[model samples]
Target: MTKQQVNKVVLAYSGGLDTSAIVPWLKENYNCEVVAFVADVGQGADELAGVEEKAIASGASSCYVVDLKAQLVNDVIVPTLKTGALYEGQYLLGTAVARPVIAAAQVEIARKVGADALAHGCTGKGNDQVRFEAAFAALAPDLQVIAPWREWHLTSRPQLLAYLEERGIPCSASITKIYSRDANLWHISTEGGELEDPWNAPSSQVWCWTTEPEQAPDTAEHLSLSFHQGEWVGLNGEAIDPVSAIDTLNQIAGAHGVGRLDMVENRLVGMKSRGCYETPAGAVLYAALQGLESLVLDRSSQDYRIRLGHEFAQLLYDGRWFTPLREVMQVAAEKLAEPLTGEVVLKLYKGQITLTQKQSPNSLYSSAFATFDEDDVYHQHHAEGFIRLYSLASRIRALQQASATDPQSGGTS
Candidate 1:
């Protein structure tokens, strides 16, 4: 579809610098009514405040800010957690997982408002563009996608800022805000600035969600977590809502410097990028859940579950959340989590969370089979027959070798 065909467009607005610029550009370039759609996926109140006013000031006909926190936690975060989905074995996939939900919400808003096209501020170089476009294709294939960054001449931030300034569009963004951050209930990620250089260590200022390991208090904090069918249910036996529970743990764990990851990850666009992430609560939760899995899952089941987790992680990282493969893998993960109801005690100190104890109703460990002391349940002498049978092939090999060396002696003697 050509630009002239679009009469109405729905933009995934974030009230950020790029998105704030996109609103006016869409109106000027397309000469169409621009509707802004924002998904409140737990980015926090500070970012959400006056967002509608900002959208309107930038030339949007109307704005729709949907509360997606509960759905995000239940439908995306919880299921991903059950699969142990961590991108590159370190990232909890906080940013990658949130994009599909945001894009899906944009499509929903488009349908409601009778929009003809969908637009987003995601850059052509990033993974998010692929993620959002993929979802748009799956959900609303008929809608025209207007990715301005890919089509526009405004290549640099300075140019984009100048464009907005010339139009008298009020924006709060400045060049001084060096780092690009994405924050949610699960984690906070920092990119750009000094983080662009892999050799440069992340300065203390780069971290907003976690304390510095050096500054963390020496005293350790112990916490208990309860799970029901792989979903976190309680903290210290007190039931709490999913978003609140994650927030509570983030505060508790962040104070102790429990989660900080620095890695140069391979991007889906075929390039490597350096990023720093702080997933305080997710780190603690993953550790606790793994401990619980150890207590309940059998050896073979555990092995297969881990393999499934790796694949699920890749699928999530690649932005295939809406595909059948993701659903199938999630179903398998849920099956593994069926008996994973339990409680785990974790000790947090200086960026480390160690499992102290774990208990589950489906536990396979038995003292009778594991004890060093004498017990009637497991006869000590039974091991002799077991070992002989286990080594029968080796014993036969040895006898065959001896006979080969003395065939004539065997016949005469």
Candidate 2:
């Protein structure tokens, strides 16, 4: 294979070991100018501090730190929450949901800086590589995409550290680092180390964001959430934006040990991987939304949304966010969520969120019709006719089977 001409390449920078080495490596291999692009999706100040200086020291010509927290919560997280997408029935997809926003931002920076190529630190074996490339293809197909992990000879953290050291570049990473973690406003995911083996129980060190369930507060806490058309509009009757809502909920729920999950999931790349996740805010929000949904959506409509949610989860996990099908599903979800205005009170304790009370103006639940005692609104005697009509096909089939078994009736064998 021949090397293509790349004058300037915009690399997604995280100031991590892999990306720090990548800056110099991209310059050395492609002989191109490297620009670091960082997307601030509320990963915290620790990760962002001195990132620009780090990138320049590692051989990047300049750095662009774009604050994408608002876009991430409103455009990506809220729309996803409306669909009720949970990957493999547990993972809240915190990491998967943030990839497209980052990729799109990286592309925007590349175009703004007049860069001809785009690069990412994603490895070939992981899903992020596919996610970043898919968004790049959809948004800027003309830009050259480069992935150093697939081309580079270095394979381990020690090697990456050495590569940076050899180039006189400073990196803070060490071989003793145990877990690979990704965090944002919604949730945090931990993988690698002992999580590589399915039989090994996660040690206390594997968890950093949420308290262990056994160590959680003894008393339960009640949270009142208000929603309008499926989006969380208020917290305890006070209106709030998406970012503040999640940040506030995350703190409240984390202390109660509301969201913690350990599972082995099948990756889109055809491999099973074990990961531990802490989605405190997401857990509470999902429970609150479902409770509200039960009150507002009718039986058939709710069932249809459940099926749609499964499909939406798969589409999101497979990096199809930029496709037409994703948009169609999102629109369908928004339509189903139009009447989801309601209030839900949830109890949080010991890694669980229980919906205690819920009410909606558009609710289908009727106390007058549902009461077990005698009620004027519902006629119990009418159910006999409805039962017969509903079971007509079954009744006909039973009769046919009985006749076929009875010789006296002259039925066919």
Candidate 3:
């Protein structure tokens, strides 16, 4: 295989087995200087710790760790939340939404370092490969993309470990690591191992971020969340920033086992894979926002939002974040969200989060009109005319059919 001519390449490094090996592999195969770029999207200190040192030791020229937590929550997560995107009707899109942000940052680093090419450790079979490459194509079409997984001969984890060992590269990954997990502030997803089989129920070993529902505390936990224009603004009446709010909710909700999901989801790569996900904060935030939307939005508007939510979910899942459709839909969502300001209380108990109370200053609910009790505000007889008009077309069709059937009234024969 003839390698493309390249001087330098920046790789999305995670200090993982695949990326650790990719650093040296790119250097060896392409003979290009590899500059590792790490996006700190709140994956945590343990994952980021020693990442730079590891990149350099893995034969990379240098590394740049960019803090993307704030951008991630504000630009990516919040915007997607506003659209109410739930991929496949359930997945919170924790991993999908982060890709464009990370990829764009990787491109920026590539250009800043004067690199001519970008590289990634994404496997060819997975959706992340398409996501990273699609963002790369959109952001920097001039720069060449080198995906090591598509090029490398190493097929499995053990093979990757052996390849590193053979090259004398230090990697902490072992064959015993069964589950492939991805974690950030929004959620954590665990795949592979027993989760690969849909028939097999996820064992206790599968869940890392939340407690087992059976073992959760006996007492239920209550929470009051405030939202302004589709964004979570306060917690328990105390003003909170988006980042702090998610972190606080994660701890509280995870303790109650309120956001754990186990199911098989369709991947954008034309495959279905089973996994377990924990979106503690996301579950609470979504519920609160939905409660507020119910209070503020009219019936027709709410139905439209539901359709838009499905479209946005597919768009985000397919990694089309940089496109114009996303911008248009986001603006529509923002407009719908304008009136979605209110407070909602939730009950978290035994892996369940339920909306207990909802209130908005702009609520369309009117007790006088809705109550069964006698009220001068609404006339009961007025509904007779409205119902007749509402079913006017059906009534006309029925009358025509009766006239056609009765020979005395109409000589159709």
Top TM-score hit: 2
Give the clashing pairs for model 3. none
Tens digit per residue, CA lDDT, model 2, 21-84: 9999999999999999988988999999999999999999999999999989888889999998
Task: lDDT for model 1, please.
Answer: 0.89
Instruction: Put down candidate 3 lDDT per residue, 232-272, tens digits, no spaces.
Output: 88899999988867888999999998888887988888888
Rank candidates by lDDT, best first: 2, 3, 1
Error of 2 at 22 (Å): 0.5
User: Where does candidate 2 clash, by residue pair?
Assistant: none
| RMSD (CA, Å), each prediction | 2.9, 1.3, 1.5
In model 2, what is the error at residue 278, expressed in angstroms?
A: 0.6
Give the Å shift of residue 265 in candidate 1.
Answer: 0.7
After the best TM-score superposition of candidate 1, give how far the Cα of residue 104 lies from its true spot, in angstroms.
1.6
Q: Per-prediction TM-score, please?
A: 0.94, 0.98, 0.97
Number of the predicted model whose lDDT against the real structure is largest: 2
Cα error of candidate 1 at position 177, Å: 3.2
Off by over 4 Å in 2: 1-4, 374-377
